[model samples]
Target: MWTKRYSEILLMTFMSITCTRAESEFELRDVTLHIIPANTVERNSELNLTCEVNVVSRGGNTPDLKISIFKNYNNHNPVYINNTRSNKVTYTIAKAQASHSGIYQCDVSAGNQHLYSSEENINVTGLQTPELRVDKLKVTEGEKVRVTCSAREESGVLEYTFKNGLKVIYKESSSSGVVQRFHSLTSTETAKFSCSYSIHVGNGVLHSSVSNEVHVVVEELKFTAKITILPSTEVIEGDSVYITCDVEGINKNSSVLSLSKGSRLLPRNYSTVVLANDSGVYECRAKVNSAERNAYKNLTVKELFSTPVLTITPAEVFEKESFNVTCRSSKIASERIGHDDVKYFIYRSNKMISSDNGIYKTMAKNETNGNYTCTAQVNNTIKWSQWITFTAKVLVSKPTITVLNEVILNKPFRIECRSDRGSLPISYTLKQNHTTLSHVQVSNPSQKAVFTTSIQSIQQISEFKCEAQNNGVNSAQTSDTLRAQVTVPVGKPNLITVPVEQDITENQQLQFLCGIPEGASSPITFKWYKEKNLSPVYVTTVNFTNAEYTILSVEGSHSGSFYCAALNKAGKEEVSNHVNVSVRMARWKKGLITGVCLMLVTGIVFAFVIRYRAMRVKVASSNGAGIWSVRPPVLDSSEVVDVDEPEEPNVEYTEVLHPQNSDPARVPLRKGTDTVYSEVQSTSPEFHDEF
Candidate 1:
């Protein structure tokens, strides 16, 4: 027995030494452990742990061993066991809790030898819970906003959750490596948001922080400014006008203000003041930080000015008369400065004749007659307010009259008057021995006044004077007076004849008479003349109203010439032309009975004588009487024969002297012829006896 027991002991001792050498060879190989499902834990879920081993084969690979997982490195508390004989192992904790979250180990054991073992720590995260945050607490609607969500206490990657009142509106993953941005968020979108995250941790799910709450105030963007114009009065050119722009209620603090004419901007200035050159509308604008506003205004400028105008009242005046004149002006403002102390000057002929405080005055005695003007002067220059013109006149003086000639009956004469030189109206008056004769008014301004009158038989005696008056003033009486003379005269009577003849016979007696009219006053002289020479034919110087003288008989001497003459107190006058008268003896005045008886007796006696003388002359002529003997013998004293002579001559003798013949023998015989013879008486007586 002893011998056999010793032999077994020796064999056991040899095997134990061989086993130790094999374990040392296996220890020289490298092994790695990896856990599945990461090292993080999540709440209300299972914890799955996977163990993996990476082995490097060194050339003695018998078979890959199986792996086992232990919780907290304890072999008795096995979380997983794998019998498949591989290098990887997996362990799962179902219904896991916060208490189950801890470090775990992976073990790979074959037979009774531990091949590989590794420990991994795991953290339990409540799930993939995410938190959200907003950078700004309050934001206007339609503004760009940022929403962020992150895992709690772990930052693997970031994501953003955008929601509107607990509703997921948008989501972006942090895998893009950029911050998520949301622009122009609405008011509803600024409410509560749901967010979650996933990160690389021990747990498969991610934990989120709290949900961020933000109040959103929707604000309407307002960009506005005001425009103000300075010195709001009547403005003129070349004057400065100031304009300003005031910005208000803008969205941004930093902005620019723009001023323009139409659309062009002017140089930079907040308040603009410029010398106005044109008149129109001006525009101003304000540009805020992304906002704009504008304003406009109109400006005007004037060119002309207003002043005072002058006028004159009652533009004319009379000479030497006291008349009121007035100067007037209009459109003068009642609030005019220093106008109450204005002075006016009255000017005539371009000379300042008078001056007054309000309107100028004229002298009561007019010195000159012409146009008068007025002007108002301020300082040295004349104001347009006062200027006017008017006309004036003067009066004339009275007149007096004088007479230069005397007036005669049935004659013509004239009178004259004189006056002083002036412009007033004047008239003249004529008087006869202080009694008014005629009154005449002279309208023209001439030198003298004259009147002409005639003297007739009706007015035998008259005296005259003249006076003149003008403007109620009379001139002195004239020194000269007119005189007159009166007289009467008669006319001579004319002579008449029966037969107008040149001469008269000697025996003819004509009648001559000197006479005048019954009422004629005359010392008349009646005388007859021959031709124009005076002959002593007849003369009668008699002063009688009706005187008559006669020349009873006229001879040849009265045929020479004849005329008459008459004289009066006026003058002496003669007969008109001339008259001639003739006278002769009457032959028919003898008695007719005596003339017849004497004619018969003378015839008878002449017959007897002629017979006696013829008987004797016949005896003588029978005896042949010669012519000398027939001349009867001259009778002697004894031989004278007696002839009976009657008491009156038998015939009247008429002078029968013929101028051409003077011989008496050539006288023709008066009666019968002379003859004596007796023979035949005897025979006649015897015959008577026988019967």
Candidate 2:
């Protein structure tokens, strides 16, 4: 029995050994391993992977498989892996990073028998947060701008938040993308922004890093302005100019002010004082620190005008005479108005007389003969406050006269005429014995006239008158009457001697004689006077045929009045005439013969000298003499001769003895002889002659 039991144990043991060999061969198959993500993982993100092993046994029992995960198969140790043999095994990672990505493999074996094995890649993809970007790096005040955020994965929606410090100013969420725009934003409103994404990450939302801070600046408001004047369109002197400043987009509290002529800053209180003399453009500017807050207004200062006053002197009325009219005004302060700046316009009889400097004067009279009135304009405004009027009347003047004498029928008489003085274009009329004698016209009126008439006989007294008239009115008149008396003589008297020069030479005698034919008037008286003095020098009465009177050796003291008087039956008549005489030495008698002799001798000698000089010149000219020809001949050709050459020769000289006797019939005299010689010079030498 022992032998038989040993044999069966040997057989069973061989069978068990064969079965174990089959199981080992089955476990020798390769293990198949795989991971959920086979390529990449995001930094600090979960890496979930499931590793599996698929084995097919060759002959014996199924093999146990071992699997592990590593970062790099050539570098780092396994982070997590499953080694137990199952159909497949799962690996869960809380966070996966670059360190969690590597190669993975599973090993399958039965005891010492080898099984199938496989390898896979664990990628560990990275999950990144969405990033925000801005179109502009910075923002200015009142500027419109935008911000954008995006993700490379395109797996979820993104939301953006813009903040200034701790305050959020802008927020936008969009599933399409994270791009937001902010329009018309103040600089203080925008600062920092961040982008958040709605993605699957361990059960919570993820946000990206904030973008670079965006800065914004705010600017001040701007303004514009203009200025204008009211009422009158033109800016004139002395006129009140209403100034208004129009301003837009400027602060209300700020004022518009004018600069004082040359200043750059605004004046105090932003107001300007207007003066009549001040004229220029004025500007108003708003006072603000911002460039946009400043504005300007232009104000123009116009010149002021004044009215002038006109006054007439001498009451404006005159009797055909001249008078003066003057204009006056109160002095204007130069600071308020310039001297001579006011213009004066004088209106008279609808005529305008202009004076820029304002002081005017004029003369008025009846001769002026015009209606006069004046008006003044100040600052372009007409002034009628001052006016004047006047009238002139005809003026009378003195009278003048002209004297006349006439002789008729052996009798002498006088007449007078009158004229008006200082009168123009005067007329005159004369009357005698209640009858008009003559009428005369005069350019200037005068009261004076003269007339003379001879009276031989008269039957009655005669009257004469003269009158001067001006402007159709009688201005002056005068009249005179004279009685006439006559006596007849027996015969005409013979005047043997009449008193001549009453002023006789000293120590000289004067004589007078009278004669009458038979049957003449009985007694005739004669008298003598000097220059018609009050007293006569001599008087006598004679009725004879011859009468004579003589005063011997009369002196200057004997000179007196003289006259002749005849008395007969009717009335006595006297004739008196003035005489004047003077004594002086006679110039011709003083040196009569001596003066004649001197004049005669001087004239003869002058004529002779002139004749001699003219003859010498005639002779020299006839001979064609040069300066050298007039000079004395030299002893030898080399001898010096002091000769002044004549400028030119007289071509048509007369061969007369003297220029004073330069008649063509005269002949030229030789140098040393009184005989006349005539010779004509020919161009041929054969015609030469010596004289």
Candidate 3:
């Protein structure tokens, strides 16, 4: 097992290296296959096939080119040893037979590419006939003779078939260890035996002509041997019986007599318990010199009950089908026991599936597939039937297909195909428009196969489907057809106006339509932009056929180059051709502007006229001050108008002063402390003095 795993690892590594270089970088050509000696060889001879290749090495020791040899059209795989790193490799077939003939070819692996070679035919003709022989030309009765059948010149694996008068009695492969066989004769008669051999060659078998026949004769010796049973030849099992042997027609002192029961030598008079197995031919042998004589008699011991057999109704049972199994004994010795005394039971593997009633019937299921055995019991004599295996074949169920995402044009998308129920080794095929895209065989029923494909055109997306088949490819169950339309890439968008005009006035409703060449299966997202701004002013997702961006009132802000972009499941953006839009004012707006200008001029003139009148109403004053008042303004005092100025203080000469009116403390000390000061009178009588 370890060796097998190591070989696998090596193979994987070699393949990895072989694929390291790009296919175009590989330089390989001129692979030729040659046959040695001649195109044809006789049987039991040697034939050689050589494959030669030419490869351009990549600036190193000769690139270790790998070569694979093949026979017929199975060129994808090598005949043996898979790949070998030899420029020229020879395949030798020793002891060649007709089975080894075929058209041969070779494949060369260099760098990363593979090259095919021309074909050559190798033919192996003729077969060696076998020889048959016997050790004795004549043998006494009840004696076994050694028979040898061989093909001395034939060396390879051959099948030896020994025949008795055109009827094959024994056949075995040459690889089997048995070389010589024994032929036993019970009655005095003449018999002929012959042999032939067959060899397996390229997809078929080749048989040689029958060999020459050898004849042998059996006769009774001069002194005969005899055997007798005391009770009877036929008896019930477990009954004791006596057997005796006697010799005649020779001196008793000279001839030796003995009894044998199937290779076991017994006394001249033998006694033992008779059993069902002991019911066979017993022999008595007498030997003198270089000759032996034998006599045989058949004994019959009845079995208490025969082995039970388990039978099925339908040999080939499939899942969910009804089937039955039962246990029954074909023979029950009525003399020993009645049929009702026996009981029957059935089992699956080691677990009993049926009770004493014997019959086990049910609808076959996947779990019911196993080995079944049956038994019959008569008290303690239980007999079992040989085991028989039953396996159910489950039909493939209808499959369902699902896509991983949406199918995009020119992009690989994954599609999963699955069958809910089926037997192992179910084959799945993916098809587009009835053309097979890919196929795979799944060993696990629960496993699903994934295939990658892309839609290059609209026609390629029509009707993709999956086929599930367990019986054969020709007979397959189909899944519900998946009709997938490709998510077409957003084509160059075409932006247009409602009236298809170049200019429009403000306050006028405008409609801008953003559309693609064709609709996509998935919703298309549209973006509308004006001028050279990187951001779109209006964005929406809808079918491109009916997508539009509308403006309730076309304004100066909307008066720029208008364009739109469209995006779909294709994951790409496409922009439309720019359409310039100009917005201008209406003629009615000019009159309204003129009227507002007249009102502004009248108001300014009126304000200026009022200011001039006010300036005229003002009066001048000497001090630079005055405006007109409600009453007349008073005159400035230049001379004494009302009363004469008070005369200068006459008392200035001797004005008396009140000393009690003056205080020395400036803060006027109070709080129950009286303090006073005298003051001198001033001559300014115009100013009254108060303390």
Candidate 4:
């Protein structure tokens, strides 16, 4: 058992070290964060925070980054976040307020690695004016008035001050920059109240401008009426009631007295058993001609019971769960005069659905969801509670993150997050590893949430995922990691000829290769083109970078500016630099030169045959033992002949002659003569009549 444990420990340690080494190649480092205007940011001025970081990637491609600037709000959630491939990110606050002053730090994430910057607590030099609100603008002397002072959405260790007409009435410090204070009216006068707040900064304090004033009036009674209810202030329905009113310091003989309920009149010093409206305000009026004084009081009539309140036993309800809805009142007037007094009925959308005596039970489902209310009744009196609503929530299934298209480096691509089953208004968060890329809320259940993003490196493909939430709970359903194809655009093609200068002669092999040095997507298609031609001379697709085109018998027609275009499945194209291909000779010109050379060789060989025949005639003549002289032929002659010796013996050359019309130097010596000798001439015996 000890050996097994030791082996397991070794395996775990090895795995941990291997994981660390793998991530060591990628680093998020040199993280530094700062703000503009080094001293302080004046309120209502533009402020900027800059986060700069340096990263090392696992490979040659740059790693994707997530930079966030966080404040002490909502558990340090990011106030500004950016999904980028750049080294620096800047967040701007167009109008800095008191709330903008706080401790802030920056976080930089590269791949699976993270780094954080030191915190910077900045100070805003100015403050916002607090707003003062009063619950009662007019009140009697010694009556309590509620006053609330609030700053502009500011928090974190603030001091609030409340003043009553330039006198400090209350002061308090709280983390929430809002405070409520109650001030009792002291005298019969109109008083103006205002408030201000302060923030503690470095070695000093910053106070806000005084808020707008709220005026409160304290009224003192001079001549008023006293009212009393008989048979107790709390009374049962259909009971007799008594009300008495007395006015102070009134001249009874000159002034007429009037007692009224709402708009009806009653006799003064009334002592009567009465039946009246269920609820109304009673007032006493003393009128002396046109000078009249009045005082009013609101009298609340007693009901069989208070308004019913409908509540669910469990605050949260999900589909397929069971809960109860109960209705009850705080007080009941003892079931006045009925058998089933204070009976309860529950309603669903104003339609009575349950008469279960203030309680109902049902399963939480979509079919059972609606607005519900309950009522308590006795005789003709009824009290209905406010409506309570239930919309059953459904737990979201695991989300699926799909890459809508093949991911292209540094180009925006769409990722869709979808849950097969969930309620409407689902919240989806797209994430890269542990860092959030973006958030989307899908209110329409039929549609999926889509987010668009780009990455700098291909390694981030496996790190992308999404999470869905709608249950109003802490847990969220997450999708599997993204898996999709990746493509890098082909770089510029480098085209080169076998002959570096691209000059080649006819019948010489010429080869040109199109290649990319780096950053090419395979398999790549290479198309070779000549100058300004729409069609390609050679087309090929290959997995390797280079594609070669060879011409075994190069022709002059192949000469011109030539280049190649390269494109991959990624659909990005690049053209190579053009190379001028100059062939020395054309096809027809070479054929013509060859024909002329063949004719020249044939003429030389024919001349040699004629000379051999002339030499045979000469040898026969020499055997005849004498030397013979040749004579020129006459002008305008068809043919010329030459004798081999002085004694003409052979029949092949009958005579040797020269042209008499031409000088000897001007005459042909061996060929091309106006008159020619036999032997080296076209007019020899070997010559046919075809000449």
Give the better candidate number (2 or 3) by TM-score: 3
lDDT to native, each model: 0.52, 0.49, 0.75, 0.76
TM-score of 2: 0.21
Top candidate (TM-score):
4
* Model 3: how far residue 221 lies from native, Å: 73
lDDT of 2 by residue, 400-509 (tens): 44334322335445555443333345555656556666665655434344445444444333544455555455444443454333334434333333345444555555
For model 3, the superposed segments whose C-alpha errors exceed 4 Å read 1-371, 374-391, 401-404, 473-475, 478-481, 498-503, 519-525, 532-535, 540-546, 568-571, 585-691
**What is the overall TM-score of model 1 with all chains considered together?**
0.29
Where does candidate 1 stray beyond 4 Å? 1-332, 337-339, 358-367, 378-420, 445-453, 456-462, 473-623, 626-691
Model 4 lDDT, residue 512, Cα = 93
For model 1, the local distance difference test gives 0.52
Name the regions of candidate 4 deviating beyond 4 angstroms: 1-316, 319-324, 329-340, 347-357, 360-371, 379-389, 443-448, 471-473, 496-512, 517-523, 532-553, 586-631, 634-691
Pick the winner on TM-score between candidates 1 and 4: 4
lDDT of 3: 0.75
**Estimated TM-score for each candidate:** 0.29, 0.21, 0.34, 0.39
Q: Please count the clashing residue pairs in each candidate, in the order shown.
A: 26, 88, 2, 11
Q: Model 4, range 1-691, lDDT digits (tens) per residue?
A: 9999999999999999999887687676589987886527777778889999877667745567888998853325788989988889999888776667778888887766788888888777667778999999998655679999987456557899899887899999987767899887756788799998888754567778899999999876344456666765556655566777666655667556777876677776554432223566777776543345676766556665677789987887778889898988777667565434668899987888888488899999987789999987766657788998877778788999888887888788899999888777789999988898888989975676889998887788899989998876564898899988888888888999997766788888899989987766688999999999999999999998899999899987888999999998778778999999999885678899999998998787679756755554332233322213332334754333333324333333324232223223322223222233332222333333322
